[model samples]
Target: MSIHPYIEQAIELLKAMISIPSFSRQEGDVAAMFEDFLKSTGINYYQRKGNNIWIRSKNFSDQLPVVLLNSHIDTVRPSSNWSKDPFSPYEEDGKIFGLGSNDAGASVVALLTVFRLLEEMQQPFNLIYSATAEEEISGDEGVASILEEIGPIDLGIVGEPTQMQMAVAEKGLMVIDGIVKGVSGHAARKEGVNAIYKALPIIEWFKNYRFPLVSDLLGPVKMTVTGIEAGTQHNVIPDECRFMVDVRVNEHYQNKELFHLISQNVNCELKARSFRLNSSFIPTDHPLVKRGETLGLRKFGSPTTSDQARMPFTTIKIGPGDSARSHTADEFICVQEIIEGVNTYYNLLKDLYIYPV
Candidate 1:
C-alpha cells in the first residue's frame, strides 16, 4: 500500500513548484525553491539572470553527443473562474490543481526525476537538464541566454502538455501591422478617398490568401486578420487605416518568405511586428523519433507554439498533462499522467544512440 518513490518525489516536487505563483517574468521564488531542492540533492547547477537553472552530468565527455531535456517554470496569470486560490495546491481524485500544475510543472518534475535516474547509468550520449524561465512571454532572459553556457546541444526533448504524444512539428508565430493611406475629406460629400475602403481589398486578400506550400504533417499556413481601426468620426473620412495580422506558419515556409508573400500581394504599406519564431520539425526517420515510435507515442503536428520554436537545434515536444488543460480556470494534472510521463521519458531515452551518418 505504498506509492513508488519516483511518483512520490515527482508529486512532492510538483506541489512545491505550484505553491509559488511564478507567473511569466516573476519566477524568483520558484527558482529559490528549486535551488534548495538541488542543494539538498547535492547536484551542481548554473542560475541564469531570470532564474533559468540548468545542470549537466559530471560524467559527460565532449566526445559524445548531448541531449537536452528542458521545460519552463513559468505560468500564465490565473483566470477569474477558479474554484480555489490559484497558487494554493489542492488534490482531488488523483489530480493536482494549481496555476502551473499542468502547463509545465508536471513536465519539470518528471524531467528532473528522469535526469536523476539517467545520472546513475553510463549512457551513450551526454544529458543536460534545464528548468528555464520566462517561457510564457518569450522573454530574452530565458532559454536563449542559457544555451551558450550549456555549450552545444545536438538534440533536445522540449517538454510541454501533450498527453505524452510526440509533437514532431510545431508551428511558428508572426504578427504584422498593415497600414492603408488616403486623403481625408468630408464623408457626406464623398470628396476624398477613404482609407477604410482601400483597406478592404487588403483585408479580403488576407482572409482568402493561401501559401501554396503545405506541410505533410502541419497542413497549411493559417493567416487571420485579428484587429482593425479607422475613421475618427462619422462626419469625416479617415486618411489612414491600420490593421493587424496573425500568422501561424508551417515548417515548409520561413517567416520571411511568408512576409514576402503577403507584401507582394497586398497593395498596402506593411510592417512586421514579429518574425523570429521559426517552425520546427523532426523527420520520422530520426533516431529519437524512431525510438519514440517503438514506444508507441503518436506523432502529430502541433498548431500551438512552444519553446521548441525558439530552439536553434532539433527538438521533439513530449510531456504529461493535456494541452487543453493549460491556461484554464482550474488547471490541473492527473497523478496518472505524471507517472506515465516519467515512464515514457525513460523509455524514449533508454536506448537512444547518436552517430554520424
Candidate 2:
C-alpha cells in the first residue's frame, strides 16, 4: 500500500541498470546484475545460454493464468554528443538522462521493481520477468529461445516505451533488399551498363509508388526506403547496387501479397539479380488489453515493431517514456512517469490475478 518505498527501489534499480552499457548482444553484464537482484529478492530465476534472464514468483496459482512481463536489456549504440557520459546515470530537471534511459532500460528497471514488489507481497499468479536481448535487429535469438523453452503463455505485456499508453496493435514490418546488376566498365566509355543507373528507375518508382491506405484499429500502412548503397568509385561504372526498404503493413495486406507486388511491379531483373524479404508480426487484442483499458489507460496503435513479433502470445505493448526521445542524443525519461508506470503494471497484475471475474 505504501508507494514511496517501492518508488525509491525503482529509482535505485534504474540507476544500477544505466551504470552498465549493454548494447544489443553484449548484455551479459547487465543480465548478471538483474539475475543477482532477483536472487537477492529470493525469487526463482535462471539465465539462458544467450544471457537472457527469467524470474518467476513462488506464490503462483491456477486461478489466474501465467503473465509474462517482457523487456529488452540491450540498447542501441550510444551517441557521441551526450552532455553527460552515456553510461553514467544522471538526474536533471526531474528526468533520468542516459543512453538507454528512454529507449527501454527505463521499462526494464520499472518491471524489475514491480517484480520485487510482487514477490514481497506474495502475488498469486505465476509471474515471469523476462529481460531479453537482440531486440534492435529483430529478436530472433532471445525471444525465440524463450518461446521454444517456456512454451505458450496466457498473456504477455511487452514493456516498450509508449509514454504509459496501452498499445493494442502495431504495424507489421517487411524488410526488402534489392540487388541490381550491370556491366562494369570505364566511365569514359558509354558502352557499360551502369548498375546505379539501373537502380535509379527503381528508386524513382519507389518515390512515386502509391502505398495503399488501409484503415484498421491502427491507421494506414507505409513504405520507406531506409538504406541505399552503390558504386565503389566515381570513375568506374558499378557492377552491383543494393538498397534496403522498410514497409509497414496493416491487416489489409498479407506478407506474401506485398512481396509479390514489389517483385512484379518494380522494374528490374527479377531472375538473375534479386529481392529478399522478411515478414513482420501481428498480435491480436486479448483480455489483458480490455482490462487495462477499464483501468484508465489510453489505447493507441504503434507504427514500429518490438520483441512481441518474435513470440506467439496474446501480447500488448505498454510502458513509460516518449518514443521521440528514444535513440536521440540526451535521451531521457521523467522520474514521475517511471513511478506511474510501476503503479500501472502493479495494478495490471492485481486485476488479472485477484479480480478475474
Candidate 3:
C-alpha cells in the first residue's frame, strides 16, 4: 500500500531524529532539531531544560479533562554489534534502521503526526503532547518534572514500542542494597561468625520468596538476588557481606509494602535504593481501553518498564515497533508499523469522551 502523506512526514522526521545521537541526558541536539520542526510547522511549544518539549493544542481548555500523549526522545547507547552505523539512518525492505528506531523514535514521530492532525480538528478533551528527555535513565529532569508543571491530567497515553498492543499494566522496578553483619576473625581459627554464612539464608529467602497477592494480568511480584560480595581475604572472615536484590513489582502491593515486608523477614539490614518508579495499571473497562478493544487492539501486561510507570494518572501504552527490537543491535521498525501506530492512536482518542459532557 502507498504511504499516506502524514506517514511520510513522520518517517522523514524520525529519520532526522535517528540521524542524531540523543543518548540519555544528552538530548539537547535532538531537542533543538525538534524545536526547529515545531517552529517550521507552526506548532506552539515550550522547551523545558533544553531537552524536554511540551505542546498543547490551541483549543486547550482548563474546563475540559486533559489527555496527555508522551514519548521519550532519549535512547540508550547503541550496542556494539550493529553492522550499520548507529547514527546513520537507513531504509531497507520497508524498515527504518538506527539506534533509537524501535525503542521510541517511532513512537515520537507517530505521536507528533497524531498531534498535528488532532490540532486541526475539534476534540472531546484537551490534548497535550510531550516529547520527553532522560527516559532511558529515569532522570528527574524529564517527565517526572514535566508532570509537576502540567498540573492535573485526566488521562495519558505513554507511547512505547508495544507493536500496537495496549499495555494495561507495566511492572515497577526497585533495587535493594543489603548488608549482613558479623564478627571478623581468622578463617583458619573459625573464631568469628562468617558474614557469608549469615547472608546465605537471606539470599535463599529472596530466591524463594513470593508476594501473597498476584496480579491477574502481571502475575506475582518477582525478586532475584542478583549480586553478592563478601570477604577481604581468603584467610579472613569478612565482617560485612553486601548484596543486591532486583525486584519487579506488581500492582498488588506498593514498593514500600514489599520493602518493609522483606526487611522485617530478613535478619540483615535491607533497604530500598529508590521506589520512584511504581507499578502502573489501567482498568479493562475504562472508556479508552474499551475503545481500543473495539478497534481489535489486544491487551497485556508489560514485563518491561516504560514512562507509563511514572505517570500518576491512568495510562495505556501503545505504539509502533516491537519491544524486543529495542536497545539491540541494528534496531529497526517497519514503515507499516509507524503508519499503524498513527491510526491506532487516533482511533483510540478521536471520539471517546472520558467524562460525560
Provide the RMSD of all predictions against the true structure, rounded to 1 decimal. Answer: 1.4, 4.0, 1.1
Quote the positional error of residue 146 for candidate 1 in Å: 1.3
Candidate 2, residues 76-193: lDDT per residue as tens digits?
9877877788888899888988888887988987887777778666554677788898887675567767776764577778888998888777777777777888899999888678
Residue 36: error of model 2 in Å?
1.6
Better of 1 and 2 by TM-score: 1
Q: Candidate 3, 327: how far from true, in Å?
A: 0.9
Candidate 3 all-Cα RMSD: 1.1
Query: Model 1, 1-357: lDDT tens per residue?
Result: 575686687798899998998988799999989988888777855455568999888788988899999999999999899998888899999999998999999999999889888888988999999999888988888888888888899999999999999999999999999999988999789599999999998899889977899998899999899999999999898999999999999999889888998888988899997777889998888998888888888999999988887788889999999999999998999998998899899888874786662
- Residue 79, model 1: lDDT of 89
**Clashes, model 2:** 0
Give the whole-model CA lDDT for all candidates, comma-separated.
0.89, 0.75, 0.89
TM-score for each model = 0.97, 0.82, 0.98
- Model 2 Cα displacement at 182 (Å)? 4.6
Which TM-score value belongs to model 2?
0.82
Candidate 1 off by > 4 Å:
1-4
Identify the leading candidate in terms of TM-score: 3
Question: lDDT of candidate 1?
Answer: 0.89
| Pairs that clash in candidate 1 | none
Regions of candidate 3 where Cα sits further than 4 Å from its true position: none
